[model samples]
Target: MKLALGPLLYYWEKQTVETFYQQALTSEADIIYLGETVCSKRRELKTRDWINLAKQLADAKKEVVLSSMALLEAPSEIKILRQICENGLFKVEANDLGAVQILAENKVPFVCGPAINCYNASVIKLLINKGMQRWVMPVELSRDWLIKILAECTQLGIREQFEVELFAHGHIPLAYSARCFTARSENKAKDDCKLCCIKYPVGRPATTQEDQQVFVLNGIQTQSGYCYNLLNDVPSMQGLVDIIRVSPSGTESFTSLQDYRAAVNGTGSPIQLASKECNGFWHKIAGFQTQQ
Candidate 1:
């Protein structure tokens, strides 16, 4: 299976973001996804900067993909999304329907990002018709459901030529909203918010009444309280997933790449070392609940 480093999900200083990608080069991942997947307000890296970083990583012998914003709310955002689609380099991941429309119009090969809501093989077929070269399962889809989708694809005579990717490890990106939770937490309105997300690099953790971490607030993205570590599931994922996504949360999270690498090669135990263990999502249960 291929290992991919997902794009940065939180705000960071320009140099800090650059240093993380440099460190990623030596990690066990084969694919490095560049570009911002969240709020475009975070100007730590511009479009040109992301393209430059993609070039550097590609030069390092890594497959690179440019990812688009998951929640686009403005004309400027759509304008840039168009610019990214026109960027004739490596394949791009379309996180929203707008990106899909742009890429489809150009007949450009692109990846269907997780936020696309491809719940069945029919949706997958529709995307395949639109030149989708890759597909990422929604974070909520379980292994059984994924297998079912693939089976349906076979029965429908739709060749699943598209590579399948999974959110194997990271803080589960549960939802995206127009409301900036991070900004609200900092007592700032979404429109006038000054980069408050940077203050909580890893996101402000929201715990339950029992003091168990349940969610993370990053701008408008709400991620799972527990890191979704799928180390133990790698063996089962071997032939199923073409690429496993390891999200870059903050600097400390890149260690996730090594641990996932060890799990990939069967040398390390990821479930044993996860900051907060969680397998319920794989089991199709409550996402935050843990299981052995």
Candidate 2:
């Protein structure tokens, strides 16, 4: 199975973002996705910068893909999405229906990102017909659900038409909203608010009254409280998944990528699940619960 580095979901300093991808040049990841997928206001890096970075990674013999924003709330966002689709040098991961439409209209083969509401084989078939070269299964879906969907695709003889990717690691992106939760948390309005999300490199953790961690607030994106890990489940993903995506959180992400690589190669010791890690979604259980 191939390892892919998913796009950065949280905002960070411009240098930090550049440094992360520079280190990724030698990481175990086979494919690297670059972009600002959450809020367009996070201008630490612009569209030109992302395309330039993608070019650098492609020159290093790594498969590079430009990711589109999950939510486009303005015409300017659509303009940026069009630029991403027209990047011609690398594949684009369509995160929303508008991106999908743009890519399809341009006759560009793209990867359907997990953010897209594609739950069944019918949608996969439709996307495949529209030049979708790969499909990243939505994070909320379970292994059983994926098996059923792939079976249906196989029955339709379109299973081999595209590759299947799984969001195997990192915090699960739960949802995206028009409101900026991070800005609101500081009693600031969405428009006049500064880029406060950059202050929290990973994301601000949200807890319940009982101090139980529930979710993470990253600008407009809400993520799972605990990291979603599947290092121990790599054996089961061998034949089913073509790419295993690990969302970059920080410097330690490269280490996690190494561990995942070792696990995939059958050269590592048994991995210990951290206290704040969960993999229940893959086992068809509560999302925040760890099966082991």
Question: Can you list the residue pairs that collide in candidate 1?
Answer: 214-225
TM-score each candidate: 0.95, 0.99
lDDT score of residue 11 within candidate 1: 90
Q: Write out the backbone clash pairs for model 2.
A: none
Lowest-sum lDDT 10-residue window in model 2: 267-276
| Alpha-carbon RMSD, each predicted model | 1.5, 0.7
lDDT of each residue in 167-253, candidate 2, tens digit only: 999999999999999999999999977888888898999999999889999999999999999999988887789999999999899
Over 180-274, each residue of candidate 1 has an lDDT whose tens digit, in order, gives 99989889999989988999888889888999888999889999888887878888886678888988876666677777777778897545645
Give the TM-score (vs. native) of candidate 1. 0.95
Model 2: residues with Cα > 4 Å off, grouped in runs: none
What Cα-based lDDT does every candidate model obtain? Answer: 0.87, 0.93
